[model samples]
Target: MLFLTSRLDHTDEEVFKIKQLRQLVEKCDELCVGTDDTMLTKFLHYTRWDTIKAYQAIHAYYEFKRRHPTWLARHSIEHYRPLFYGTHCRFVMPHVDRDGRVLVIFKTVDGFQRFPDYLQSLVEMDDLIFESLLLLPRVQEKGITVICDLQGTTRNFLRQFSPAFMKVVNEKNGVLPFSQRIVHIIQRGFLMHVTSTLFMPFMNKEFKERIFTHDGRHLSKLREMVGYESLPAEYGGPASNVLDTDLIFNHLLQNADYLEKLQKYEKL
Candidate 1:
C-alpha cells in the first residue's frame, strides 16, 4: 500500500519513495510496528529522502524518547497548563496561515522564572500541542509557524535558555512529524538578540534559515507573511488580544479518543 498518498492517485515517484522508506523501517524491528506512512514521510523529509539518513533519523528519534522517559508518560493537557497561566507563553489566534500552517504565538510576560523542572514542562507542553495538532487531518503535513514575542523578556529569562534546553528542543523537533516553517522573533530586545545568537549555533542549517528577527518598530513584513487578519490585535491585527488556553485544553479533551488511536501509529 502507498503510505504517503492515496493508493488510487499515488504517482510512481511517490510509490517508490514510500516503498523504499517502508522497507528500511520494516528492517528495523523496533520501528516496524509503530511507524506509519506519515511518520516515514516525516523522517524522509527530515533527511532529504536519503535512505541511510532517514533510517538514522528514525533510530535517533526512538533513542531520544527512550532517554527522556518523562516525555513518554502520557500526561494530560491540564498537567502543563499551570506553566502557561498568566504567562506570556500561549498559543494565540487559533487559525492557519496562507500556507496552511498553524500559527502559535508565544508572548514573553513579566516575572519569568526558570526553575530546574521548567525545561521538562516546556517539552511536555510542546508534545501536547503536537498531539492536538495530529488530531486534525493535513495539519501535520502543513506544519507550524511560531511567533515568539520578546517585548518583556529580561536577561534572567534569557539566561535560562541554556544549551541543554536548546538541545532538547532540537532533538524534539527532529522526531516530531510537523515542521516548523518559521520561528519569527518579534519585539526583540537586546537580551533577546543575545539569546538568539547564543542559541542559533546549535540549530540545524534549515532551522537557522527559518529564523527571522524583527523589532517592534513595524510589523508589515510579519503581517504580510502571516496575513493581517490571522494575527491578534496586539500584533497589529483584528483578532482578539485575549488568548484562551482552555480552548486548546478543551480541544485535547474532546479529541482524546481520536488522539489515543493515532498514538498507536506514532514513532515516538
Candidate 2:
C-alpha cells in the first residue's frame, strides 16, 4: 500500500514493504508501506501549532487540494482523527472551559464565510457557541480543527453582554460594538458538518489527569473516549492510544516502522 506521512514542514509518501518494517522502538517516526493482498493506502499526520498558526497548518492541506484538482480526481485524501480519539466524530464538537469561556476555531473557511445561510443562522446562536469555528476550506482534508477554548467565565460573560449593549446603540444611532459587528458579518455554514479532532496529549499521566479534570463536568463523547483507556482489541478499539496516530506521532519519533512500508514503493 502507499503510505503518506505529513508533518509541520513537509509531506512525503512511499511504498512500504513489510520486510522493511524492522522490529525496533526507535524506528517509529518512519512511515511504512505494506500490502496484505489488498488496497494501497497513505495515512498518518503530525503537526502542532501554538495558537493561530496551528489553524493555518491545518488549512494549508485544504487549499492545497482545492488548488490542485487533477491530484484530487484520482486520489482521495482521507482526513483522519487519531483512533484513540476514536471513530465517533462530531462535526461541531464545541468545548467550553470550566470558567465558561467558549473557544471558537477557524480553519476550513474562516469565521463562517463559506457556510450557507442555514448554517450561518446557527452561528448567531450565541448561547450555543461561546467560541467560533476556525474554518479553512483549504485544509479540511488534513484532519485538523483548531483548538479554541474560552478565556474564562468572566470574559465570556462580558462578551455576551457587549452584544445587547450594541443593540441598544444600533437602536439609538445604528452603532454596534466591534464584537457585535464581527458577529453581524458572520457567514452561515461553519457549524453545518459534525466534526472532531484527532488529538494526542503531550503531557504525562499527572498532567493529563489535571488538565482533563478542568473540563470533566462538561463531558463530550470525544472527551470520554480520550479520558478512558482504549476498548479491548476484539471490540474494535485500535489496540491502544500508544499505537494510535495522534499520541504516537505526538509523543515520539523513536520508531518509524509505520513509514517503512512507503519506502519500498518508488514514488513517495
Candidate 3:
C-alpha cells in the first residue's frame, strides 16, 4: 500500500483556498476533521477546488462516521481475508489507469457461498481500499476506476447482492472522500441485465452516468478506456499483470496501522 508521494507545490491561490477550508473545518468542533495539508488538498482535489463543496464533503464524511458508530466499529480486515484464500473476490490492481486513477478489479469467481458475512466483508474492504487509495496524491487527484469481472459469477452470488445492500453501499459511497470515476461491468445478456437492474436504483446520477457496460466477447473498448497495460491478463493485458493474491495481501498488511487508526475513527 506504500507508494512514494510526489511533493505537490500548490499555487498561492490554491494554498489560500486550503487555508480557508481548514479554518472553516476547524471552527466546527463537532466535525472530527483532520487539518493535515495533504488530506485537505485531497478534499479540494475531488471537489474541484471549490472550497464550499469540499467543506460540505468533509462534513458529510465525518458525520457519516459519527452516525454509524456501531457499523464502523465492527470493520475488520479478517472479514475480508477469506476471499483471498479461495475466490479472490476483490482486489485493487497493481497499476493505475491512463488517467493515473487507481483501478480496483472485482471478480465473482467461486461466489460467496462460503462467506455468509460477505456484505460486511465487502463494506470493510471498500473502506480499507479507499482509505489506502486516498494516501496517494495521484489517486486523490484522479479518482478511481472499477472493473467488475463477472466471468464466473453465479446466480447464487448475484442473489446475495440484493437491492437493500446496494442502497447501503451507495450511501457509503456518497460520504467517502475519494471519487469513483467509472465502473466497468463485464457481463452480458440476462446476467448483466439482472445485475444492472439490481444496483441502478441505488446509484447516484454521476455514478450512473459513469458506468460503462462491456460484454465478455469484446474488451477492446475497456482496453482503450484504461489502457492495455493497466488491465490484468484475464482482460487481455500482460501476463505479468495477472492477479496476485500475495501482492494484494502484502499491500494490505503494510497498511495495517492505518486500518487500526480507521477503526478508531469509526468509533468517533
List TM-score per model, in order: 0.74, 0.17, 0.86
Model 3, span 1-268: residue lDDT tens = 3254554588999989989999998887666646777678778887889999998888777677776653452545655676666666667777888888888887766545676766555556656766766777777777889898776666876777877668776877787777556889898677766877788789999778988888888999999999999899889888888786666666667777665565664213
In terms of TM-score, the best-performing candidate is 3
lDDT of 3 at 40: 83
lDDT of each: 0.65, 0.23, 0.74
Report the poorest 10 consecutive residues by lDDT, candidate 3.
69-78
Q: Looking at model 1, report the run of 10 residues with the lowest lDDT sum.
A: 1-10
Candidate 1 vs candidate 2: the TM-score winner is 1
In candidate 3, list every pair of residues with a backbone clash: none
Tens-digit lDDT track for model 2 on 143-234?
A: 22212232111222232334443333223211101111111011122222111111112223432332221131233442333322332221
Q: Where in model 1 is the C-alpha error above 4 Å?
A: 1-27, 32-56, 70-74, 86-88, 110-116, 239-242, 257-268
